[model samples]
Each structure stands twice: as C-alpha cells, then as structure tokens.
Target chain A: MNAAVEIDVKSEAEAFLIAEARLLDAGRFDEWLALFAEDGFYWVPAAPGQSDPLNHLSILYEDKSVLGMRVRRLGHPRVYSAQPAPRTAHLVGNVTAAPGAEPGVDCEVRSTVMMAEYRPGQAADRRLWAGQQTHKLRRTPEGWRIVLKRVDLIDCDAVHGILAVPI
Target chain B: MPDSIAPDALRRLVLPDRVHRSLYTDPAIFDLEMTRIFGRCWLFLAHESQIRAPGDFVRARLGREDVIVVRARDGRIRALVNRCTHRGAQVCQAERGNTAGFACPYHAWTFGLDGALNSVPHRQSLPPDFDLKDPRLALAAVPRVESYRGFVFGSLAPGGESLVEHLGPIAAVIDNVVDRAPDGEIEQAGGVARQEYRGNWKLHHENANDTLHPGFVHESSVSAARGDPRDYAAPAYDGHQTHTQMLSNGFGVREWQSLSLTGFPAGHSYMGGFYRGGVLSPDRDDPVWREYRARLVARHGEEKTARVLGEDRFNNLLYPNVSINAQYQQIRVVTPLAVDRTRVTAFCFRLKGAPEALFHRAVRFLTNLSSPASMILSDDIEIFERVQGGLANSEPEWLDQSRGLGADRTEAGGRTVSAGLSELPHRAQYAAWLRYMTAAA
Candidate 1:
C-alpha cells in the first residue's frame, strides 16, 4: 500500500477507537453494540497472553448476540449490580494500525486504555482498569465494523470484584 | 483465640435454627475459625492433573499459609509451606511453574520438590551447629496431604479424620463426576478465574445449596434472558447455553420444591440439578450430546452410562471451601482472606476422551457462573456484600436458618435429606461448625 493509504488507515483507526471509547463512557450500549460485524467477538481474557478462548477460560467471550443480551440486561430496572449505574471515563491512546489479515478487511488497531469506574453513592467502589485492546476492523457496505475486539488487562489474573460493564 | 470466645458463648451464638450476626462480623470469631475450622478441615488444593509431571507446582492457600503443591521426582505429591526456613521469605514467587527446586530470592536457600533443604549459600559461614541435612531446617510440610480420585486435599492439623472420612457420603458425588468422564478420567483444563467479595467465607457455602435465592437474587439475569425471544427460537445462537443457564434460575416454586437437597454428617451437601430444559438439559439430543453419549457408552456400556449420566447433582459443597458442579465439570474453590472478605477461584475440567467441544462448553460454564463479569454471579456477590453491610448494624442479631429445620429427615447412610428450598444445609454446616469449634483441641 502507498504511504498515503497507510497514513489514512492509521488515522481512521485512531478516530474509530476514540469514538468507540466515547460510546462506552456515555453508556450508549445499544449504539456501541451496532459497531460490531454480524459475527464479531468481544473477549476479555482472564490471563495475559491467553490465546485460546474456546478451550481456555476467559473473563468474557461474547459474540454479537450475547452482547445484545448484555446491553438489554444493563437496561433492566431490577439489575441489582447496576441499581445505581456506574459512571466510567475511558481514556484511549497509544494507537497503531496494520493491514487486516484476511480479505474484505480494513486494518487491525491496537490501543492502550485506562477506564475509571465509580458507582453512585459508593465512593469506595471506585476502580481503575487498565488494559490493551486489539480491534480487528472489517470494511462493510455500511462502514467499518469491528470483527473482533480483545482486551488484555494488565491485572488479568488478579482476583477481581464485580465487573458489570464493558471495559 | 478459641479461648477468647468461650465454648458456651460460641455455642449459644449458633442455636438450633439461627446464628448470631457476630459470626459474620467478629474478627475474634474469624480467628477462631481460622484455627478450628480452616486450620483442621481437609481443604481442597490443586488437582493432581495440574501438577502431573515431576517438578510441576501450583501455589495454593492453606488458611493464611502460602503453600506450593508440587509433584516430586519420586512420583509423590507434597504440599510445602512456601516460606523459606532461613529468613521467613517466600521460596516460590510464581503462581505455577515447572522447576526442579525452589531457591529463595532472599539468600539462595534452595529446596527440592520434595521440600528437602538441598543447599544454602555460604554454608561455611554458618555456625557449626547449623545442620543443612536437619529436617527442621527445611520448609515445613503440611501435616497431611491426601488425594481422592485425583482431587488433592491438605490438612494443617496434625491429626484428624482421613480424607475419605472427612468427605463421608459426599465421596459419591466425586465418584459420579469422575465416572461421567468417557475415559474414566478428567484433567484440569482452562485457566482459573478468581473473584473476591466483601462477605464472610461462610456466606458462599450457605448460599451454595440454597435454592430459593436464585429466583430472587438473580432475577435480573433471569428476566433479561426471558425477555430475549431469540434465545428460545428454533435456531439457537452460539450463547444458547449461557442464556439457558441464566433462565434456569427462573425455575418456579413447584420446580424448585420437586428437587432434592441432601446434607451429610461432615458439613458436606449437594442439591439436585435443576437445569432440565433448553440446551442446558442433560436429555438434549443435540449432536454434541450424541457424540458425548457415544463416548461414555463406549467406556461404561449402555446401562452403566445411563446410570452415570443420570446422576444430576449440582453445587456439591464439600464443607468449608469447595463447590463442585459435576455436570458442568467445574469446581469453585473458596478461600477466606479476612473476617469480611473471601476469594473464589473457579476451574474447568476436560474429560479425556470426550469431544473437544465438550471441554469448550465446560469452559463457557465456568466463565458464565464464576467469572467476575458474570451476570449471574455479580448479583450473588452484590447480595453478599449487601448482607455484610446490613449485618454491620447492631439490630436483628440473629440470622434465620429455620426454613426447613423440622422438615429434615435422616435417611440411610446417615444423610440428612430435605425439600429443595430447605435451609437444612446451613443447619448441617453449623452443626459441623460447632462440633469443630467446641471440640477439645
């Protein structure tokens, strides 16, 4: 590819990731769910450098449909864990992009993210989650959609408390 | 600590049907439990499969002690206190690894996999009376390390009931789990996912067999799953089992009451399985089920396979620290970290000869039920923390365990059986707790 094309892809990927983080922080889960391809995956592995989501345990490995259910559950009035919804600030930076591996794909984006979460009226429940994310983008007729998004937490194996929202 | 809290006073705190809130809030009582209960009980450690080869090790916790459960070169498994005898520094720093010996980073005091003190740097500088070969200079070994059906357990107490005796009739549940394996063996697969909650350790065990709480506590997950029409449609999605598992919590009063809840003498108990619908159902005729059934039948024949797969006990609580779901090939090990905090680590097992997909499904089961991101488990954890917060108040000193006190009946082999919604397991647990707490040490 030409240098101009590479620069465009890199800039586009960075913009896409920044927008995605904003959607999560804004609690627009339904709109966030629309950013995925039909068979897109959202994985949060329990261990760093974990490769197998099928044979190995992950904190979460949800396909698009499962993500739909999660979005619905977060909106439920009786959701005890989210009774007082959590407020999150997602900071994304250090982004880079490379061409996608397969055909009909755009590029692979990698970015570092630090998410701060605080539940209302529970100051002690505040948490700061830091991780690196790999988003595989595919160019669809509509626009660029995420083919796979994997989050690798710095403290992936740590004994965690309740993590109700997406990181 | 046990003396600090009088036996009679402790006994009074646990009546026939209710327990004092202090049991959940008092640090002194927690300390006593660390000695009497956790100190003496046969706590589940790493499985043999995790450290199958020589020199393989996994770090585990025995109450407050950090232990390394390792397989020695001589084919023997040993649980050694990870602390170095030289300066009380930890000998092993990694969670798990394959190493011939552990060398303390502080002073290079080396110890073998069998926990024998191998060598120490600057030996000549030590006093002449310092003997490297002396057993006292080596890392301390847990008094008793035993294995039943490849499940390793360690007890800190010098003398107590054997592992089998501690398990009692609950051993049958272990047998049923291993028997379901097509190759007659199961190995630990998938990594462990851990979650900590701000609640007493007893809360996990108390909630394990309580059937009534699911519909109330996990109502959000259940209702959300019910609201998803695609989950019940003819063409199922990839997360069909995940959705169905959550929906299973919506089991009604009649369905819950029809199941059996049995408690054994040794504070161990198991509740009958309730996932009898959708893809979570054992009788599902999917291709994966067909393949698994064929593999099991190949090993145990038709009738035996039927008997093995037919045993559907869920949440088999082995007293103080372990809960097993044989049907899902999952185990959740609970560790008490403080008076008001506990940690649970969940692992999945793969049947040796079963299809690879079966193990994948088991991994999914572990994630859905035990992962910190679990919709079902987060609710349970929220309730646990809320209970801890509520109990901090001085009022309502007693927590009820009387739901099924009079309904319990003793059966053959000294097992206490009750209705599915019964709190009989809590009573049985406290019965064993009082026995351990008040006994002559």
Candidate 2:
C-alpha cells in the first residue's frame, strides 16, 4: 500500500478505537455492544495467548450470551460492588496495524490502554488498570466492527479487588 | 528489643471462647503468627499429582517462605527453598514446570531436583578450604515435609505430630475428596484461580464455614438467580437480635440450633447443613450427571454416596490452611500476607472419571457465585475490609465467638458441631489458633 493510503487507513482505525473508548467512558454499554460482530469474542486472557479456556483459566472469555449477562449485571443496582459505580477513563495509545489475513478484512490493530478506576470503599482505593489490547477489524458494510477484542492485563494473576465492569 | 511482644500480652489476646481483635488486626501479632503459628504448623504444600512426571516441579509459599516441590528422578517428591544458597537468588521463577535441574539466573549455580548442589561455575577459583560437597551449601529443605493421599504439606518445626496424626478426624474429610473419583484419586485439573483479598487471611477461613452469612450477604445473588424483580439487598445486622442477620430469615433459631458440628483436634472442623437444597444441574437430562451419580454409588455404596453427595457441608475447615467443600469441588488455601492482607487461592477440582457436565457445573457454580468478580464475593470482601478497618478502633474488647457457645455437643472424636448458624467453627479455630500461638516453639 502507498504511504498516504497507509496513513489514511491508520487514521481511520484510530478514529474507530477512540469512538469505542468514548462509548465506554460515557457508560453507553449497549451502544458499545453494537460495535462487535455477531460472532465476535471478548477475551481477557489470564496470561497472554492463553490457548484453552477450559483446562486453563481466563479473566474473561465471553461469547454473546456471557457478554449479554455481564451487561445485564452492570444494570443491576443490587450489585454491591457497583453501589457507587466505578468510573473509568480509557486512555488508548500507540495504534499499529499489521497485514490482513484475508481480502476486505483489515489486519489487526494493537494498542495500549490505561484505565483509572475509583471506588469509595477500597483502601489504597484507586487503581490504574494497565493492559495491552488487540482488535481484529473487519470492513463491514457500515464500518469497521471489532471481530475480536483481546486484553492482556499486567496484573492479571494478582488478587483483583473488584471488576464491576468489563476491562 | 522493645518491639518484641511480652508473653503476657500475647496470652491475653486469646481466650477460650473469644480472641482479642489484635490477633487479626495487629501487625505484631501477624509477625508472631508467621514465626509461631505458620512457622510451626504443617502447612499444605502441593499435591503429589501436581508433579506426577519425573522432572515436574511446582513452586509454593509456606508461611511467607517460598519453597519448590520437585519430583526427583527416583519418583520421590522433595521440597526445597527456592533461594540459592550462594547469593540467595531464586532458582526457579516459573510457577510450575518440568525441568532436569534448577539454575540460578544470577550466578549459574545449578541444583538437582533433590536440591543437591550439582554444579557451580569456577570451582577452581574458590578457596582451597572450600567444601562444595557440604550439605550446608545445598538448598535448604523444609524441616518437615509429608504427603497424604497425594497432598503434600511442609512444616518449619523440626518435630511435631505426623501429618496423619495432626489431621486426626479431619483425615476423613480429605478421604471424601479423593475418594469421590472412581479411580480412587483426584488430580488438580482445571487451572487455579488465585485472588487476593485486602483483609486478614483468617477472615476467609471464618467466612468459609459461616453458613449464616450466605442467605443475608448473598441476597443479591440469590435474588438474581431467582429472577426476582426486587433489587438486591445487603444483609443487615440487628445488634439486639440473637445473632448476625447475614443469612436470610430462612435459617430460624430452631434450625440453627440443630445443625451438627464435627470438631477434630488441631482446630479442624466441619459444619453440616443444606442451605438451598443442593444445587441441581441446569441440564438435568444430561447423561453425564447420571453416569456420575451411578459411579459415585458404585464406588461408595448407596449409603455412603448419599452421605457424601446429599450431606451439606458449609465448610470443612482443615485448620491453619486448607478448606475443602467437596459438594462444590472448591478447595481454598489461605496464605497470609500481612495482618490485613491475605491471598486466597481457590481451586476447582474435576472428578477423574466423572462426566464433563459435572465439571462444567462446578465451574459455573464457583465462577458465578464465589469468584472475586461475583457480586456475592465482592460484598463479602467489602465486609471483611470494613471489619479489618473497624478493628483498629479501641472500642470493642473482643470479637464475639460466643454464639451457640454452650450448645456444643462433644462427640467421640475431638470434633464438635453446633446449630446451622452457630459460631462453633470460629470458636474452634480460635482455640486452635491460641494453642498454636502459645505452644512453646
């Protein structure tokens, strides 16, 4: 691809990512939900490239139903952990694209994210969640939708305080 | 020298029926526990099956001390400190693996699976009087290490009761866990879920067998599962009431009074009661459950199978460390990090020959209801942290373990049980905690 075309592609991908982050920041979960493909996977590996979710564990390996359940849980006020509700600001950076595996499907884009969360009750109370994320984007009729969203947390094995929302 | 605790102050922290708040909240007491209790008690290490192969090894923490358990070429499992004797650099960094020998990243000092000093670079440069073959240069082994039914445990105390004797009546509890599999053994199958709670480690143990808190503290979960329209409710405690109102009103005074407690020596205990009529699988028609039931019955016989499967055990506290809930395939180990911080590692086990559905059910139950991400667990964690924070206040003299105090029925063994909502387990644990903390090292 030409340098100009590559720059345009990169900018477009960055815009898509920024929009997704905005949706999450605004607590527009349902709107963000629509940005994924029908068979898209939302995976947060216990370790990077965790192959099997069965024998090995994952922070999250949600399909449609599981994702739906989590979204529904977020709306439940009785979720004590969500009493005050966690506020998150997603900082996305360093977007890069790789070769596409197939035609009409753009290659994967990698980025780093730092999520700062606050809860009223926790001691040393604030957490700055850091992780590297990769998104496989496919050119849909409307625009680029996430086919796969993988999050690799820096402290995935460390005892987690509470994760009320999707990381 | 002034920082050292006087023996009298330590004695006053523990009583027969209750313990002072300092035991759980004081840093000094925590340090002493590391040296007195954790240092002396036989702590659960790792299962032998975890290192089935000749070269397999697993690294674990025994009371703030890091040790590596490796299967030697001769098939014997050896537990050795992870630290290299030369410069104290960790020999193995990985959580688990199969290796011929461990090499220190810092100096290339290598040790055999048995922790014998196998090689060191530049032996000629060493002093002529240096004795490389001396045992002191080898990796330090835990003072006492033993295995029962594939479960390995290590104790820093040089002399104590054998692992089996220390386990006492609780030995049956371990047997129940391994015997569930038709092959007459259990292996760690599904990967472990390690989570830390910012509260004292003992809180996890106390809460494990506290059947009374579930219905109340877990109201949100129970309501969500029931598909109720009402919002989730947090458990409320009425100081005037007989006991904490953590559980729903379902467990009335009469029912709480009638529950049985089986107390074994060394602080092990089991509380028996069915909370919500054991959970039924979502897919009742699945052939796996049927085959599992059949196999259980075949191996244990109808009476024993009913006892094992139907009996409700809120928590079987294996004092000092492990807690096994067979019905749920949940085993939790508490590793104390500080007075106010504990790392609780929960492992979900799979029956060796059971159906896949059985394992699936266990995963669903554990992850949905008990994992750190669960609403119920978060609530419990909140309360624990609150309690840990509150104990700093000088108001309360002692935390109550007086509930159902006089109601304990002494059985043939060292075990004792109280009503479903009784605090017998907590009291039993404190008693053992006191004994261990006070015993001469």
Candidate 3:
C-alpha cells in the first residue's frame, strides 16, 4: 500500500468536498456547475463494486452534457416530478485524499455521506440515504475543479421509488 | 355481498365491462390468490446465469413462502422452501450468494446445496427411531421445478401441465428477448430496480398493457422532453371513450403510434403501439446500434432480422405476474404483500456478444422505465395509488374496461387480435383468473 498522503494534499480536497455538499444542500446549482472541470462525470453505481459504467446499469450516470441537461430540467418550472422539490441534508465525513489516478489530476478525495431527505407533500415522507462518495479533482487555472464525483449507495441494489430530484 | 364472500361470487365480480372494487380491496381475495393463482402457476425461479456455478443460489419468495433456488454439486438446479425443519425459521437471508451448503443461523442446522439434510445440533439428543432421511426433516423442495431455455421456473403444486405448455404462445415473449441478442443468449445480468407501490397488484397487471393513459398522465414529462403541448388546454374527455382518436400521439415515440393488442390463452398478450412501422428505435445513426444491427443481420439474415427487429410493441405480459418489454430489454415482475401493497422489480437484460454500448442502451431503458426514480413511470404509480384509495368511496361498484370489445377476432391457438386501445388483455387475464379460482386443484 502507498504511504499516507500529505496533509496539505488531503485538506484542500476535503474542503472542496465539504463545500460541494453544502452547495448541493443549499440548491446553489449554478455555482455548483462552476466547481466542475470541463470534463467531469456524476455517477451512482447499481451494483456493488461495479467498475464498468458502460456495460452495467446505474441509477444515475451522466457525462458533462447530460449533467447540463439534467440540471436544466431540474430547474424547469413545468417539471412535474421536481415541482415541490425534496430538500436534502448531507452529512459528509471520513474525508481522505488518495494519490491521483489521472495524469494531470490534483487529488482524489474519498468520503462517506449520509443524506436524509424530506419531500414536501400531503404525507411528508422522510427517507434516509447513505452512500460512499469519491471526488476526483484537477487543479485548474482558477482553482481546483471536480473531474468526477461518484456515489455508491448501500441499497442501490434495492428498488427505489421515483427519484424526483438529484441524489 | 357486503357481509361475506362466497366462492361463487368471484365470477360475478368480474363483469365484461367492469370489475368490482372489492376484487382489489378485499383481504380474503388476496389470501385466496396466494394459494389458487400464485401457488399453482409456473413461477419464475432464477435466470440460469444467476446460478451458473455449483453452490450458487438466489433467494426469492413464491407468494409469501420463502424459497431458494440453488445449483447443487451435481450441476442440477433445485428450489426448496427456506423454512428450517427445526423451528420454521428462514435458513438463508442473503439475496444471492455462493456457498457449499446453507447453515441456518437459528439452530445451526445445515443442508446440502440441493437441500438435503446434512447436520443437526446433536445426534444423541434425537429419539432412537429418528431418521435423517425423511424429506420433511430436510428442507422441502418445490413440488415441481422446470426450466425452459435457461429461464428456471418452479411450481408449488405437485403436477398438472408442463411449463412450456403453461406458457403457451406467451413463450414467444421470452424468445423475442433472447433472440434480439445477436448471439442466442441474453443476461438479466444487469442490476434490477426493485420498488414498492401502495396499490393493488392488479393495477400494474392492467397498466402493463395499457395504451390509454400515456397522453394524459405523462404529458408534462413529454413536454419537457419533446417540447410539444398541442393538447395541453383541451378539456379532459369524460370517462369511457371507445374508438377515440389516438392519444399516444402526444407521447412522441414511434411505438406510441396506432395500437395493436393480441391476446393469447393463459392470459398472455403483447401490445404494440403501431399498426406498422420499423421498430421504435431512435439510434439508427449511432455506431453502436449500427454494429448491433449488422451482427443481427449476419446471424438471422437480412429478411428475418428486419422482420424480427421491426415490431413496434410497448409491453408483453406473461399471465399471472411477469411483464416483458423486449424493446427495452426488461422483464418486470410483481410480488404482492397485502391487499393494497405490491413490490415491482424490473430486470434489465444485456445482449451478450454485442457492443458494450448496446448493453448501455438496455440499461438506460431499464432505468428510465418503471421504478420510482423513472421520469416516465412514476406517473402511472401515482394513479395506481389513487385507484386503491378511490375504491373506498363505495359509490361505483365496478371500474370500466369496455374498450374495443366485440371487435376482437379469434386467431389460431385460442389467441385473439384487436385494434387500438383494446381492453381484451384485461379480459384475458380475468378469464385465466376465473379458471384458476374455480378449477379443482
């Protein structure tokens, strides 16, 4: 195994992730877009330890353009499913930076997050979603930008009802 | 009728044009269904790929009875009731796994992969005449287990008819899915989306082949995707309009064109959205789809391949519980929990030996269709729940189903064909239900 990563390398990545979760929780999606590198991906694997996104099914698998479309749709006034949006509170912990896998990457931060959501409706149902998250960041000219963010949910194997908003 | 349900009243509840609400809301009927319908039918066990190796297993429930399908040391597949002989506790808890044998955590009772009793807590504690060889002392195997083209099925009933015969013409639905793979094999090897709906299970069965609700229920999602809202301001038509103009037009998919419904014996049917067209494919320009078509042409030749790939069907139902969408590479099944609760699982199948993108497309369909997270399917789920809630009003005793009746023409092998927005599939299902309820098992 590789030696423990430097604290400087680890802290910046940790801060970026915590701030990213805050952005999502606050619904500041416009600023959230700026945090990503030109080439970035958001993915949620369907199976445990699923390596091939191309061959396997995932709850959400999107490249940059698809992500743009999804963000646009989430903002659409007429989008029925996201009408009265569900709000999420994220608890992100265990942030640690791993050696970069990309040729020109800054660092990869691996963290675990427990998200509880409340969707506004007659029933006002509450759901708890817990998952492991990984973010690959690149040092852009402006600052560090996300190259990838992957969420591996514990119950991704179980059937989920409508996922109205982004996870 | 309000006090108690006589066995004879089951037939009266299912009138040609409508069915009574009690059929959905009654706890007694649900219990009877567990025995008369689900117990006798050839229920799906496991895909052959899921249990490819010896000691491989997948656990599923047949009705409320927990069952496990396992591949044994002898390379044979078998299903056994999961209740341990010692105390009726479930023997296995994991959904799917590989193990040489099952060890019950309750009492340490172990059984071979084929469900033969292997060990007990202490031999000396047993009575002198106690025999380990009794089948009851071991895990009880299903009365009959059969597989057709690698699709395993098991029946709780002792014996009556063969599995293939039970499937009848609906077996073609399975053939359609497997044959679409350039190679003759398909894998439901991808992930399954399991979801629960707070509605009666029959709602999904009826909705699986429903061509009536797409334009109304899914209009908003369609507008977001296709940017067309031609009929958005139109007054909603009153309930019960037969021979109505095609509502599927607003959905903006080729498969949502002129409807074609064909019903078969044993409640099997396939519903196509178009009378005639190329298959509902939007990826003619994609390199992945092109390569996939070429492989099909090479395997099934030009004419037959085009014929095979050109049907514009939406969904195909296989009798009591399963629904297959060959176009989307999905096999949907339901497990009813209570009179008002049901769980739906959609199995996504990938075509073997095709380009990886082909599998990716299949995954997209399986993800986009059905399940709670689906942009398209949640519309139906909401309505199903509404129906379950509405039945409590007690004003209308029957829900209307009299669409495209008297227009069906009988075809070969007890199959019937009908035109746009036919309710013949629902009739066919109830016909099978009637037979099962009254039959002398």
User: Model 1: per-residue lDDT, tens digit, A4-109?
Assistant: 9989989988899889989999999999999999888899998889998888888999988788888899988888887688899999899999998887567899
Error of 2 at B381 (Å): 2.1
Shift of residue B41 alpha carbon in model 2, Å: 1.1
Which candidate comes out best when scored by TM-score?
Answer: 1
**Model 1: per-residue Cα lDDT over B216-240, one tens digit each:** 8988888888888673445543438
Q: What is the TM-score of chain B alone in each candidate?
A: 0.97, 0.89, 0.90
lDDT (C-alpha, whole model) for all candidates: 0.88, 0.73, 0.74
Q: Report how far off residue B202 is in candidate 1 (Å).
A: 0.8
In candidate 3 the C-alpha lDDT for residue B29 amounts to 85
After superposition, the stretches of candidate 3 with alpha carbons farther than 4 Å from their true spots are A1-23, A26-38, A72-84, A94-107, A138-145, B1-4, B227-257, B273-279, B282-286, B370-372
Kindly give the stretch of ten consecutive residues in candidate 3 chain B with the minimal lDDT sum: B237-246
Q: What docking tier does model 1 reach?
A: medium
TM-score of 2: 0.84
DockQ of 3: 0.27
TM-score of chain A of 3: 0.92
